[model samples]
Target chain A: MASGNKTTLLFYPSTTNVSAKIHPVVLFNICDSFVRRPDQAERVIGTLLGSVSADGIVEIKNSYAVPHNESADQVALDIDYHHTMYLSHQKVNPKEVIVGWYSTGSGVSGGSQLIHEFYSREVSNPVHLTVDTGFTNGEASLKCYVSFNLSLGDRQLAAQFQEIPLDLRMIEAERVGFDILKTTVVDKLPNDLEGMEATMKRLLALIDDVYNYVDGVVEGRLIPDNNIGRFISNTLSSLPKISPATFDKVFNDRIQDNYALVYLSSLARTQLSIAEKLNTAAQVL
Target chain B: MANTMARSFLQAVATEEVAPPLRVVQMEGLAVLKIIKHCKEFSPALVTGQLLGLDVGSVLEITNCFPFPTREEDDENEADGANYQLEMMRCLREVNVDNNTVGWYQSTLLGSYQTVELIETFMNYQENIRRCVCIIYDPSRSNQGVLALKALKLTESFMDLYRHNSFIGEKLREKKLSWVDIFEEIPIKVSNSALISAFMTELEPDSPVVQCDLDRLKLSTAPFMERNLEFLIECMDDLSSEQNKFQYYYRNLSRQQAQQQTWLQKRRTENIARKAAGEEPLPEEDPSNPIFKPIPEPSRLDSYLITNQVANYCNQINGAAGQSFSKLYLMKALQDN
Candidate 1:
């Protein structure tokens, strides 16, 4: 839909469910492509592949970088390369349709509209995701936008990029990997026990924070919010009742069974090593 | 200075003669996240992808990865899989990404990844890549607050034995390679660029304990433990059957030995009679006798895979139980206080 306007017309998509859900993998891919970009290239751009549900929620699942050349006045995209990459990606994930395109920079630049138009030709309405890969404002700001086609009299090609709500969602395994990636100073990946220890420590810190907040509110040093109070109470109530005696008995019994198997495995391993040694000795003989 | 140069040259030669074993698998954070997303998104249905990176000395650096096409969707032609991989790698190379296939990664369900299929995939990769590893990620285990990602490779001795296709008892004995020697695990190291680390730090929510951390506090791990136990029992049964096959082979071999002994004695008697009669005796070894036929020894590959799977399940159960114990104790203390 277009309107003859002298300036610009900002219009949202017809559907009310216009929000976008972005997988952390897409962000990781964008950042990676940005890092591996050519030395002279100022920014890297790629096509976002996902599916639009019946409810109209756009889920961006996967992406691959598309090579392009741009300058102050001229912009050119490798349409052939984009087509081939899309076909190959489709062969892998047939369901992941081209939903939008992403670029790495401070925000949407002047040449983004041309790329967005190219993607729009592929899909109905393409989203434009601009990642602040440079961390210009001391943080990498991730922003997603859906464009509105504004008909400005004779300039019927112009469009405006409108910001849309986007959330970073990941599965359980991804969160664990993300947590591990957060530790940049320690390059070594944590073992299971170390992960558990860190988790416990974080839990303990949280408990202390909650306890302090309650204490402050009770002592009248801070105003108690009813919403937080209900939230804390609800959490406490959700915990199942546990009698110390019953729990101890169940816990000990389960732990003993588990430890017994652990011991059995250890014993099996010892016998294996011994058997290997014996076999080698007999072979030599 | 001349002496130093000579010593350096000698050391270089020594290093070339004995290349270092892959002790650490250095994976980029981008690769790690990419793998997690791909595997978890398709979850219950297992998926695999090609790993691209360099093989540095003593460290296998994984830089990037792309998911493989689902078999059913790959135009129903098996050859398309290889073509897709080649085209994808070529496209990625054009984008300045690492296209060298270092290894491949696959998602596993409940740590049950040890299989002959996996080994076959490894042998296929071995043809081109000088040294490679298979990275196994178990999403089910990670759900229990454990990041179960491991890098595994075929041991040199085991690979040598595998190439001969002779996995007999004697062959294994000669190689001194037990079932445990089939796969060697290299420790994994995860490192992120400064900018990614900063971005991840920003991704962190205001709360110290996110949803995953809260999920760790969940006390009900009985389902996970139960599934692991079920798999363990099945493995034990399979292992016992394998043992029985070996037993049957041994029995047949012993009977054949006794038959040979009797046949040799008769032939000796006949020869002695012929000597007395001044006539030639028949040959002792009979090629057509069914009793003298060789009984083929069964392959230990099946048993080795089962044992590996069993050990994997055991470790998983132990880890989940241990984590649960910690959480329970913390909860108990919190209540008491």
Candidate 2:
């Protein structure tokens, strides 16, 4: 799978960074190349490049599929080519380094060890990322494996592939975009009446939770915390002082305006269709 | 030179149509992750789901899918189940996603996916939707560091054989079919939008320290190799038994042929003798006999599937062995250094 080279990762300024955060762009690239290959082969190999935050959090930014090569010599050449390309990419954005490599499909295969060995030569502690790009229901499963070299008798070997937890972290903007993409899949438009209704429903549910908490405190079933009380008072004070009658009138007017807009749009559509019909009839005559 | 190669690769990608002549199955990354989650949730039990996506001629874009609910069996309840599924699809339609059942997905254990139920299900779907595919999710293999997500479709020959319920040697030979060709694996692509790419790019920042962790090189292929061996052994046993059964049939057929020839020759001589005596030749030698009844040949599809399964297991084992050998080789070389 070709991990999209275009999508870059923006590192968030976090005080504590322990885990690797994968940018969605790398995923896009993997998916793109995976499906677009001339022959629909399951095995796709690519290199993972990203910058690690000061706190050991790896932020995967870019990836490119290593073109399929059958010969051992060709594979080595391809690896070199990938390294040069990565260096060129680093020139433009010097933050990223060769973090690891990725392959489309799940589970490390027989060839995976060989591929992993090649990547190991390029980077120390190369993370072998397996993106399960095969669709069953929803979402491509991503797995990060860190190899551990072990000693068996007198010979030392990489004895284990330990899976590391992958955090698919997105910035605030990305999160919003992700949510919008999710909604679009279901044909739910953001900022529409249905969206607003769903938001209101969630808001009401939160209010119910808050009301229950207050009731519990009032009835002595629970104790209220000073911080929570302070927060509630602060929130209440921040509320705009609007009369109930005016609030109702404003809400009604907004709803009416929305209905009128819908009606006007429908009328315009009908008029356009009628005009087109008349023009066609006149032409025929 | 690399730049030219990269450019050519890009050109290839740009010129490539989203859809090819044969239907291409593409899935969003999130959809695959969801299936893995579903499989994990229902571990030790067979889980199945309906694939919902748009089928644009050559590209089957699987946008979403939902797990099918287990239903209680009753003669009348079957209708209710169908209606309930329809209602669910209708709800999906309201959401503007492809609600059509393009195919279905099932979680398999140890790649033991070929089964009567799976074939029957594929046929049922094929009867309605021509481009339907079955996506198999293997969680155990995934846990061992490879995500086993595969898109499978019944080959036309296999489907035809299935429709006719004929997997006999003659039919198989006539169709030129084999187990490997039974399930045509459509390459899967996980797709994302430009917006996602842009967002990912925004998340990058420069860091001074490059992590070179030694722990990442460790690997353990023993357990996986063992499992593969076990499965391979089972497959071998199944294959051998199938071969033995076919051998038995061959033996029986040959024995019957010999007996029939002897009986026919005796009848011919008797008829000749009767003609020489000027008698009406004993009602033209009827070859019909209880001993000549044909022995039914068992379908070779199962054996073929087992053979393929065995090959798959062998490939996996070989990979594990090769990886282990390399690891050892690296360690030994380092020791010498």
Number of the top-ranking candidate, with DockQ as the measure: 1
Each prediction's TM-score against the native?
0.89, 0.50
**In terms of docking quality, how is candidate 1 classified?**
acceptable
Off by over 4 Å in 2: A1-285, B1-20, B70-84, B198-218, B283-288, B330-337
For B1-337, candidate 1 gives per-residue lDDT tens digits of 9999999999999988777888889888778877877787788899999999988888889989888976775545778787888888899999988878899999999989889999999999999888899999887766666667889999999889888998877888777778788999888888777777878778766655666665666778888878888888898788779879877877888888888899999889989999899998888888898888888978888887887888777777777767777766776677676
True contacts recovered per prediction: 0.51, 0.01
Tens-digit lDDT track of model 2 for B1-337: 9999999999888776543555567776545654765576567677887897778868788876766654456877778657656755654443244567889998987778877778889888988986788999886654433446788888877888888889876676667665567888877766545533343343332321111111112345556656766776687688778778877887888888788789888878999999999988775345476776878977776776776676566555544454444444443433333
> After TM-score superposition, what is the CA distance of residue B29 in candidate 1 from its true location, in Å?
1.2
When candidate 1 is compared with the true two-chain complex, its DockQ is 0.47
Q: Candidate 2 residues A1-285, lDDT tens each? A: 222222223222232224677765567657655655435455667788887767767778667666655453334326555755565445334666898899877766656777777778887767888877663334446788766555555676544565667886543113223333332232221322233234335445665777898899999999879899888789667756666677557545544543443444345335434533432232210
Model 1 chain B lDDT-worst window of ten: B206-215
Q: Kindly list the interface RMSD, in angstroms, of each predicted candidate in the order they appear.
A: 2.9, 28.1
Candidate lDDT scores, in order, read 0.80, 0.62
